[model samples]
Target: MSSFARHRPAQPSLASVGPNKLTQQSLAKRLLFHSHPTDELPPIFLSETLPPELTAEVYDFIALALRAYINPWWTKITRYDKEFLPQVTHILVIVIRALELRIQRLNIPALVFHDIPTILSQHYADYRNALSKLSTSYASGGAASLPQLFSQMQPHTAILPDGKIDPEYFRQVFDYILRVCLPLEDHEAEAERIIVREVIVKVLLDDVLPKVTQPWFVQKTILDLLGPPAEGEYMGPLSAPPSSFSFHNLLIIILSVLQSFSGACIALIHAYKQAIITIKLVQHSPPYKSSTLPPQTGHTGPPPASPVADQSHTFVSPSSISTTTSTSSSTSSHPLQQWGSISAEPLTITQVGGNYAAPGLAMVSEVFSTRDRFSSNIFHIMLTMLSISITSFLDKLLPYLLLNTLCPAFILNITRLSKRTLFPNGYPGPQPQEPTLEEKAEIRARLVAWRGEGVLSYFLPLILGPRPSETLGAAVDPLSSAQCNTHLLVLLLDRVLMGLFPELADGLGNPSNS
Candidate 1:
């Protein structure tokens, strides 16, 4: 027999003891040998059946162990003790498979969602700390231990039975990694891209899109979350109202546009700064040398006539006259003489030729033309109107959006309304008796008072607040606050159309169902 088999205790024959006693002892031995020991073994064997709760607890424990310990090692440990690794891996796989089957049979949605998130969060925390330590150690020229590497990867193994990660958990991890570790080259580029893409896509489909299904609710929630659109007392210009469509589709479009705009703006600012630096460098360059001008010819008028008649010009020898004239001309034309003749110090020309003018003109013209084109586009006009209206709505609704700040009166009114809509008679759970008409009236009065206060504080801001400053001047000429207000109005109209008559929006805009 193998050494392992030899070490394992032998089973006693049924004849040696009553069957019940024999079975009890066998179970006790098995329980003792299990990775985790439980106190419920006696009930499990004495009754000849395992309690449902006990089975569930055992499976949960095993699942936790597999998720926390076993799976992490799969991607790590290039070399491990073969015998030990195989044995541990086999045991873990069996436990995991068995738990998966049990979970499937149970089909408990709430338990699955709740427990899975808790497990994932715990694993994520562990992995996060482990990854940090590993990175620090590696940076210090120390090699990562196998266990450390395994720990760093453990969170990734919390996959569903179908081998997919939990959608919500995946999104949480993806966003966390992007925010925290993405700047580190080693973490960001490795397996992160695939992981992020998968999680984001899944979350959009599962979590975010579902919320968009109810248009009015979505609009209200979005207004609550992001604050309302920036309109004043008057809503701006509007086109056809939005058709009836899924709220999720509209939110997706809105979010996409916001993200795109933000990214574009950042890129533009970076480019602008770089262009400015380049222009400065060019302008500061030293001036080029001018080529030498050709020397000027000297004029010698005919020699002055001699005073004596043909005793002519025994005045001076011709050679002497010629030599004296040449010397005088050379001295007058010398650089030192030219320098002495100048009265004003030479002006330094700081500007470079072929530099600023052409490029500056071109840039200005291009920017203006682009702005004009964008301003003329109907889509841009619409988007601006939408943004403004949304902002204005948020401004007016801010007070009501606060859960804690809402008046007790408003809460009572909401409770009454909820009772009328949902419960009819009263709430499901045992609670206080039905309210009297007088009490209800008092609640209503309080709600009205709170509502008035909310409207005053919130809506007043929209009317009285200063306009947003223009980000770009005439060069870019993006939509102004007023224009954006107008666009927001149009967007609301679009929302209305989509919300009330989705078939039309679907036909017009071709928005995705998701």
Candidate 2:
């Protein structure tokens, strides 16, 4: 070898480095650096089991990186980073999930319950503040619309390469944010918690829904969030399949949204009614009466505990109570359990009963059965919302009543579901097993309970309440307002009754003729 060549230092080769000596550290940074494609997720994200250590590092890095993008005080990032956000969001979903799993496996409920939500709340506050600023700018004509304003204000985290908002991305975001926001236990200040919830409602209502270009995509997203309609499968009354979002969650969210609403109740109702109808179509059943557990014949264990003696305070069903306990346990064990584990046990009969029930029955309202505490809560909130809008804000109700096509398709679905419920054998298909006497009795009880506790308990009085104009007694002309409000109330009553009793033909006109 030549003297010059021999003088050069020997370089390390694969064999010289030795496999054991070579460190495989921080795979996330390496993966994120090289993978810039927006169309698909990086390999680390696609892996069934992600590296926990690396994932935690990636999550921290992402949280830091996203701070600049979501920060309210700094307007430094004005333009969207289209390529980075979509890919980063994919990584985020995976990394957040992996970190959640790791935290769970380590049996750290505090991190999952408190830290995650508080951290996420802080992030959401930043976003909300920035969004508020953006909204002000938009009002002054800074952008063409809300969608455009958001796209310009922050990196398009939910936007695709084709420059369209990806509904799935927002769904994941909503699911994650919502999962953390649940659990009635107060982890953060009340204001912070409210901010987090309001952000979700605003994004979904003000930003995502209106921007979606696809025809049915908005409706589909809403339905999925509210628990997709139950297929004609045989599910136990207590069976609640795990989902990313659920009807129970939706009710809580709607109630939260209402806290922020001044007069947007009609818009909120219009947005959710279809999803609610679809959910009720198949899930509708009578409220379950509390019964004593049958004594076990072959058991040598302590007898099952009796129901709580405080009949004045209605408790959620046993299954729901169990679900809350299970959720707490599962939060420390399973990652998927975090998404849709919230149950209705937190709701009390007094909270939802309001002043609608008779004075005598009001105190014993809990004695009656409800289809489910969550479903009952949904009706109560909806009734309150409708009442508020009709009596408090006639203008909002009248416009929605005239402009929207609320019932044509839903009425058809109502008829079909009614047929199935009233006459299961009427349709041509495999025969369903006839319900037992106990089942039939339970159904009758539910119907009676619904009559007393359902929307009709409040709604009939509201619709028939001294015409809305008289209730408001505002400067608006009473004659014109009365006519419009009455018309709107009747229409709303018709729709509400359809949901309450699918078999009822003339909802307001005649209850007995059907």
Candidate 3:
């Protein structure tokens, strides 16, 4: 070799460097050449370490990120990204769950703007604009034209051949929910989909209904929803072949929808209670009740000098006269001046009588309305919501809870479940015989007690057997009423379907048997 070539330094190969380059010593040496280790390490997320002053903005950012991740409307992100779904679910669980905790740790209000995210400001603005437009329509064209806004959305579409269902009227209900009521971000979140519904409901009860004042708006929407689908829609394939939709198809969906409304109902009931209290207070107050009394002499202005008495009037000592005049003026204003000083003066009997003719009549009218119209409307909405929640036990929820979520999960993972749960209280061995009326009554009573004791007390013992008494039974606390009402609604569907064929099923078996 030439002396010049031999003088060149040898370059290092991959084998010479070895696979341990990531070791601390080598990594430090590599990193030292470029930058400090702290600088090289991933920059601590700036947002995670933010100061308290920017907490609201942090929440906004999180909500926005959640919206992006969820793509609630399917417009923000594509649904084709199946692998990303789990990530979204976990993120949503964090938002739905961990967000409050994080906020608390940061020392921020747990409920900001009533838990309405700043990211939804645009959406709310749109909602307000739409509401205004709908209000205008109601005012101009009347209540009959109110549905015009929603009607713009293509009328319910049925899946021509197989989708024709009777009692399966979720097309409208689901539309109201997805399009209007509670539009969720994730599809799999149908089980937990409640945020939008709650928002819509609060707006409807507190904001929309109270201010709207249109009777038709309330009446039509309530009747339309609570009753059945109207004509020309969901009648199915307008042709020679006869077909009809059954309510059974959408029974679970409707019950779920109603169950979601329970919060709104509770709010309404609270308001109703407050209203009753207020009305009672008003009735007891001077405004609601009327009484008449004889006019009394005025203390001011020399008792309005009469023509005969004017000549006979005599002026006494200046000190005595002046003292009496000051006393009279101090005690009351003159009646002649009372007209101009109506606001300052105590209302007179004549004034009260005049008010009775006008405003009192109004109070009377309101009192009459409270007895029936107000109660009926309030109860109708409340009972409707309550019924939905109450009946959920018989619907699809119980069976699914028994068969899918709880039972299968336990039986598959925990081998000891069957012995403790089955055989004794539920299922297998003893064939269930049809009960007589007296036995059925006792069964009903027992079920009612279970409900009163709370869902956990009721369900755990049934699922885990008497062992649950050892753990969850000590002073049984009730589960959330809203949660309890959300049981699957499929079971009641059978009864509904059977009831539809009352000609055959009218008295075949007791309705309680369901």
Per TM-score, the best of the predicted structures is 2
For candidate 2, report its TM-score. 0.19
What would you estimate as the lDDT of candidate 2?
0.33
lDDT, candidate 2, 1-514, per-residue tens: 7997989998888888855358653323333433432222234333344343444444334433333233332235544333343344343454344334333222222222322232222222323343465546544654444334323433333444334445554344333333332323332234334333444445443433343422133223333444423343224467767878779999998988887584467667875997576445424432212111111111112221322122211111121112322222222221212322123221111101112212212111122211124444455456556655554233223223322332334434554444344334432224334457676444333322221233334653332233322322211111122222222222222222221122122211222321
Clashes of each: 34, 2, 24
Winner by TM-score between candidate 3 and candidate 2: 2
Estimate the overall C-alpha local distance difference test score of candidate 1. 0.32
Best candidate according to lDDT: 2
Please give the lDDT score at residue 214 for candidate 1.
30
**Cα lDDT of model 1 by residue, 411-512, tens digit:** 345544443432333222232343476754443333222212333565422322222112112211212122222222222222222222212212222223
Candidate 1: C-alpha RMSD to true structure equals: 37.3
lDDT of 2 at 213: 26
Name every residue pair that clashes in candidate 2: 287-370, 287-371
